[model samples]
Target chain A: MKVMVAGGAGFIGSHLIDALLAQGDDVVCVDNFFIGTRENIAHLHGNPHFKFYEQDLTDLDRMLKIFQAEQVEYVFHLAANSDIQASAQNPMIEYKNTYSTTFILLECMRLCGVKKLFFASTSAVYGEQMGVEVSEDAVALKPISYYGGAKLGSEGIISSFAYMNDMSVLVFRFPNVIGPRLTHGVIFDFVKRLKADPTHLRILGDGTQSKPYIYVMDLVDAIMRFKDVEKGITLYNVGVETQTSVTRIAEIVCEKMGLPEIPFEYTGGRGGWKGDVPVFAYNLDKIHAAGWRASMTSDEAVAKTVEMVL
Target chain B: MKVMVAGGAGFIGSHLIDALLAQGDDVVCVDNFFIGTRENIAHLHGNPHFKFYEQDLTDLDRMLKIFQAEQVEYVFHLAANSDIQASAQNPMIEYKNTYSTTFILLECMRLCGVKKLFFASTSAVYGEQMGVEVSEDAVALKPISYYGGAKLGSEGIISSFAYMNDMSVLVFRFPNVIGPRLTHGVIFDFVKRLKADPTHLRILGDGTQSKPYIYVMDLVDAIMRFKDVEKGITLYNVGVETQTSVTRIAEIVCEKMGLPEIPFEYTGGRGGWKGDVPVFAYNLDKIHAAGWRASMTSDEAVAKTVEMVL
Candidate 1:
């Protein structure tokens, strides 16, 4: 199988690329290096089955050329302006990088006869869930930030194309995915803050805001498992079943770093930033029914992530 | 006041131009005439207060040039590929017209120092509603169609601009607005179909899909009334509070045309084409509290729209 991993140098994408290569699949890693870094994919440089292309997904012609040349079979579209907080500030950048780029990639895939896609969506698409456990089917997707809006927009486009063009799309709404090679995330931010000053870690908003977390490797595994599902537009929540609070994550960071219980300073109240989903957990029964489940809990995932980042 | 009405030659925009001109405001009507007809705004061509410019909003330089030359004070962004069903079939065109154009417009507005804007959003942004009444405060803005997604994308950009810059934005999530000068709606489609074949009318889906309909005049009134609201980013559900079924609308269309009861044919069993929201209704309590409400009932709005189109 020939697989194209868009944003393959980013945190989750790099992990997925490694797994794909291990599974004997030929991989074409494409990245614009906006948020993605070369260091993430540098290990796979000399591999026989792995190839890399530095290109922006927003450029339709460049993407089309790559798609045709590679004869790509499956596309794991993870490239995006993944910062939810920044989207609330520079939304045009988010829309262009995330939504427009996704649209362009889909168009290129359709033109090149690629039929299968693994789209990395987010739980932020559910906005603020009313219930404690959010299901892919139950939650109405009202995204507060531009990032969520772009993901939902990309989902809608993919669904439309799937129905109209006989394309198979598996959309995974991932929770807070944390692990190594991550450029931006709550755990990464906390680690960086702690490294800068050992006294007190400045936490945005109140520390009571809670959310589910999934390890990057676990999310990548779930995505790969669900890629070839025989559904036209199958959507799944890829995350651990349990919820973890922000304060717990902070404490886990301190514990993992072998630092004295660092005093946490809450800058203010509410979520981390504007358009942040403060509290939500996912009902993983849909994906678990498919014989797939996360091995680590949210706290365990956060602790492991802190250990890796620290 | 100098107001720029993008897509001013089309349906609701033409009506808005009239209202603005009647208020002694200079109107710069910008449109590419894709669906907008010159016949719609033909009357105001020679009026000293009204000027027309044919240009695509995606062309940033062209738009900026017009903004600088016209010295526009306020903007009424009505330009978009308005058809939702068509957008599902052709998502890229819709995105380019609706989402990309909005980004360009916002950039141009920022460059020109224009602060006030009245953006025409849609109820489709709500996607499939959980209950009979949907409100602006309700989360889960899952727009099922590319059209809705594009509108939501535009809202995201506008909201971000409002928060980041000193801009006042009023976003009106209009329901099925229909009336005189309306180019497209269920009422207009039904009338056009019945005129071609009065004995047999082809209705999409089961014809039981219900939606709130607002007269164009009422929508314009609501927008004008809320234009000066001091909020940085304000959103309102602008629609006739009563819900009307498509079957009811068909009956009203037949009666208005003085035709025999037409045999309605359901093309398969979908309320609309793929990506169409089968049922939706808005909670107008917020807008009603804002000292404005739709005067016409949904049925009345449908009937009056049929009369006008016929």
Candidate 2:
């Protein structure tokens, strides 16, 4: 099968490309390197089944050309602006990059005769869940940040398109995915801050904000596990049952880095920043029913990610 | 209070403007005349309390300027592409007109210090309900058309903006709003078609699709009645309790026009066109609790709208 990973050179996308290539599927990695780095996919340069395109998926004409030429049977759309803080500051960027990208990709796919799509969604779409175990079907989908709004917008568009065009869509609402090739989020931020000043750590938000985290490899594996879904819109929450708080994560990072107990300074609030959802917990019953479960807890994922970044 | 009504030259907006003016509010009406017209507000030319600006609100700078210069205390955002069929055909136009316009308006509101807003949402935000009674609070909000997606997107942004910026917002999810100066919908379509060919009337769908309708004046009154809403985001389902079928609507149009039994031909299927919702029924419990109700039923609204159009 010919598959195109829209953000295939980014953190999770690059890892997904590796897994897809290992399974002997012909893969086309498309990325503009906006936040996606070239270094992440550099190791797969000479792989026979792997191809790369330095193009923005939001560019409709180019996307159309690529889809037509490749005859892409499945699209793994993961490209988006992940910076929630930046999006809250200026939402237009997120709208154009994330929402418009999905719009253009769906249009291109419809025209190019692609019938299947794997949409990478975020837990932020269920913003301010108040720490409840939110199920996939029961999501109110009120994204607090512009990033989450854009993703939710993309999901609506995808669902509509799938229903109208006789296409199959697999949507995975992910929690904080942590592992190798980590570029952003709390884990990377803590690791970088601690590297600069080992005696003390500065944490955003009151150390109370907490949520589940899925290992990157486990996330990729969950995607691989779902196949031949006969529904128009098959949605799943790909997250573990347990969560770790900011303070607990700080402790783990300090322990992983072989440092003594350090005084922690917090930027006090329920949320780290404006539009930041303080807490989120997903009901993974849907994904678990499909025979995929989180292998590691949030603590283990954060610790391993810290170690990998170091 | 000094107020700004975007899309003030459109049907519902114009009605809203009259109510505001009659109540002695200094009103500034803004519209691009896309689907709106000068004739809708021509009656207000001599009224000193009413001011009209023929400018698109999607222009961020222009919107900010208008907000600042007018010292606009309240904004009624009603501007949008009302054509769902046209939206599905060319979503880009709808995105710019409906979705992008909302984004710009909210940004301008946040920056210009406008704290209160009345947003016109829709039953389409609930998408295809399959004739289920959908309440405002229980809305899953899956808009089928680009127009619906845009409105749902606006709702998310408005809610987030209200939370982040300490603004007050009232969102009303309206059904097929019908009555005087009606520019579009099934009533207007039937009237126009029968006018062109009085011997026969052609319906778009299988004619079994049904949804509620609210008379324009009743809708305007509902907005006026909900005056002292306290909190961030106050939403309501503003439509009649019962729904009228397409076939029933056609018969009403013919009856109003005093025409003979016209041969009714259905173009066929659940929806009138691509991106058309088959069924919609909004639960008005919240609105009823607020001491407002739809005086006219769906059939009455349709017949009155047909008469008005004729």
Candidate 3:
């Protein structure tokens, strides 16, 4: 199978490329190097099945040209604005990065007769839930952050294309996916902050702001092993079963870094930022029912991620 | 109260202006005059409390300037690309008109310290449903048409802004809103097509596509009498309780227009166009629970609209 992984040089995308190549699928990795880097996918240089294309996904003509020229059969759309904090500063960044990119890709796919799509949606699409865990089919989807709004917007766009254009789509609402080659998020921030000054660590929200975390490998595995049913839109919340807290993560990071009793200064709030959904979690029953479960819990994932980063 | 009604020269917006002016609130009506007409709001020219601004809402700088300078308190965001068929023809039309307009409005409101928003969403957001009446909270929102996708996208953007910016918002998912000053819809199309040829009427779908319709006056009344509860995001699906079919509407139009047993020719297939939902309907229990109900049935609304058009 000839496949394209958009944003394939990024952390999770690069790992996904590895899994796809291992399965004997010829892969094309496209990245604008916004969040993704050449260093992440540099190992695949000598491989014949691996092809690298450096371009922005927002250009419809260029994207369509690539899709037609390559005769791309399947697409794993992993490219998106990874920074949640940055979105509050510029709403258009996410709108362009996530929504417009997805829109262009769907149009390109429709034009090129591509039949399948693997979309990496986020749990932030649920926004700040009243409860801990939110199921896929339950409640009106309300994405609070600018980033989440764009993501949720992209999901709607993708679903529309899937139904109207005769394509099968698998949308995985991922949790805080953390692991090696970490570009951004809580673990990376902690490591970056701690290394600069190990004596005191300042957390974004109140120490009680809790959410679920999934390892990058677990997420990659979930995508690679996704059972493609002959359906329109198949959705799953991909993450660990358990939830984790900010304090637990801070403690884990401090422990891993060999720092004793680091004074944690929290910017007291419900959310880390204006659009952050604290205490975010998703119901994992759908994915588990589909015969895919995370081997590591949220805490264990965080621990491993901390170890990997340190 | 100094209120701003975007797209106030259009069908529902003009009617909403009547209700607002009757309550003695100062209104500034903004319209790009795209689908909106001066003839619609021509009567309000002599009224001292009403002001009409001929401009597009997508202009963020201009919109923020207007909002800030006018000291706009409440906003009725109604400006959008109304034609569903045209959206599939030009996919970006709906996105730019509906989605981009809403995004710019929210940002402008936030900048101008505007606290409340009344967003006009659509049942198209629900997409094609199995059941007759889908609830506001239930059923995962999957908008199929380009217009539906854009409307759904705008709703998410509004919800996000309401939650993130300390603003109160009410999103009313309207069904086929029919009455006087009707710019374009199934009823208008039927009337126009019949006028062009009284011998035969051409229906787009299989003539069995059932959906709900609400009187524009009823919709206006609902918006005017909306109970201002202190909440971040308040949502309600506003429409008639009973369902109306396309065939029934065709019959009603022919009878009302004095056509003698016209042969109805269907274009064939479930959808009239690319994005048309065959059996689209919305549940109005949420709005009724909030102490507002439709005064007319779907059939009555259609009949009255036919008379008004004649």
Q: What is the interface RMSD of each candidate, in Å?
A: 4.3, 2.3, 1.3
Q: What share of the true interface contacts does candidate 3 keep?
A: 0.64
lDDT of 1 by residue, B138-237 (tens): 6545566767767876776575555445788888998777878777767778877887878888888898788888888998888777887574777888
- The DockQ scores of all candidates, in the order shown, are 0.22, 0.45, 0.63
- Residue A86, candidate 2: alpha-carbon lDDT: 74
lDDT of each: 0.81, 0.83, 0.86
Evaluate model 2: give its TM-score: 0.95
Candidate 2 CAPRI assessment class: acceptable
Error of 2 at A172 (Å): 0.9
TM-scores of chain A across candidates = 0.96, 0.97, 0.97
The TM-scores of all predictions, comma-separated, are 0.79, 0.95, 0.94
Q: Give the lowest summed-lDDT range of ten residues in model 1 chain B.
A: B156-165
Question: Candidate 2: which pairs clash?
Answer: none
For model 3, how does the per-residue alpha-carbon lDDT over B16-108 read when each residue is reduced to its tens digit?
A: 999899998999999999899999999999899999888888888888778877998899999998988877766767767887888888888
Q: Is candidate 1 or candidate 3 better by DockQ?
A: 3
Residue B20, candidate 1: C-alpha displacement in angstroms? 2.9
Error of 3 at A272 (Å): 2.9
